[model samples]
Target: MKLKLIRQTGIHVILAAGGALMLLPVIWMIATSFKEPESIYAFPPEWLPHPFTWSNYVETLTRPGMAFLDFFRNSMTVTVLAMIGNIASSTVVAFAFARLRWRGRDALFVVLLTTMMLPQHVTMIPVFVLFKYLGWIDTYKPLVVPAFFGAPLYIFILRQFMLTLPRSLDEAARLDGAGNFTLLTRIMLPLSKPALATVAVFAFRAHWNDFMGPLIYLNSSEKFTLAIGLHMFHGQYGTEWGPMMAAATLTVLPMVILFLIAQRYFIQGMAMSGLKE
Candidate 1:
């Protein structure tokens, strides 16, 4: 029993050390954000600033051409809309894939899975050209309209979760005059809190941190999202390391808060869904 206790203690120590190592960069980012620009590169790399300051946060928001508030609003709009589309569309498609049996359903699902394996770079140009032809080049439509079509990963996650549910519930609902839409709304959605929460968390994070899509589609400064707006911290001469870090911290705060609130559902959904398939 003593030997087993020693092993567990050693494992915990190793895990704690690994976790600290992983957090070092984040710790550094926060420290840098609080440090004076001159103190940032000080020798021995202090963990805590001698005189901490909120100037970085101030400058980050008030920087010329920053428009940080507008960026926040735009990001919120895009992220919320995308999350709604992702959950709603993914749920519908996943229901069809998981519950309903059709002639070519399984084969179509295999094909859908194959599409996920196709690198985004391969389709990037073609999709861009299609959107360009649609005259959506400089619009939010290019970033958002795609969400309503459904996400492959989201669909896969939801379908996996739905499959874990007993078919008896579906059958019972059907007997009670529940059609496909009714079954989904009345029974499936009510019971899919965890999986749906997972989907929302993921969708929120994707749009929140997305840079490439916004860069590619948005041409106007007024239309820039937070990800692209952060780039403004860099000038032709040098990057504003302190204010940029402060901006990054603010940008990451919402995602952290959101994940903390939804983490229980996220973990439970993933574990339960993975157990069956």
Candidate 2:
């Protein structure tokens, strides 16, 4: 028991040290965001602002013409739409893959998984040209529309989770007059709430932090998401690290809060998804 206690203490200490190292950048960002602009360049940087101020946040929030609220609204719109699309489409695809029987189903699944190995850059030009031809350039459609097709990884995650459910439930429901659609909606969906929440969290973070997609598709300044909007701090002369960090902190806070709220679901979902029959 004493040996176990010592080993546990050593493990906890190592984990705590690693956690602090991981969080060091976050600590610096928060500290820098509160410091005055002139003091930001001070050598052997101040770990805490000597005279903390909200000016950085204030400037970031009230920057001329590029309203933070609008950027936030754009991000929220894209995130919500992407979440809905990914969930609705992926759930159906995953259900079919995990439960249904048909010729070539497993083979098709292998092909679908192969697509995951295809780098996004390899298809970027084609996708851009297709969207451009559709007159989707400079529009949210480019960012928002593709999500409805479902992501390969998300579909796989949901399918794996669904596979862990007992087929006995499906048989029992079938005896009670549950058709495929009814089984999916009533039985599968209800029990897969944790997995769904896991997917939502993943989708939310992806779309929320998505910079390259919006940067490539959106041309107009007014349509910028928060990720792009934060780039406004980089002027021709210099970058405003203070305001930039402030905006970044704001941008990252939601994801942290969301994970904290749903971390249990995330862990459980991941665990269940890893199981094999």
In order, the Cα lDDT scores of the candidates are: 0.85, 0.86
Please give the RMSD to the true structure for each candidate, in Å: 2.0, 2.2
**Which tens-of-lDDT digit does each residue in 99-201 have in candidate 1?**
9998999999998887877888988999999999999988899888899999987898889888889999999999998899999998998988878888888
Stretches > 4 Å off in candidate 2 = 235-237, 267-277
**Residue-wise C-alpha lDDT for candidate 2, range 134-171, written one tens digit per residue:** 99999999888889998877788889889999999999
TM-scores, one per candidate: 0.93, 0.92
Global lDDT for candidate 1?
Answer: 0.85
Off by over 4 Å in 1: 235-237, 268-277
Q: What clash pairs does model 2 have? A: none
For candidate 2, the per-residue lDDT at 156 reads 85
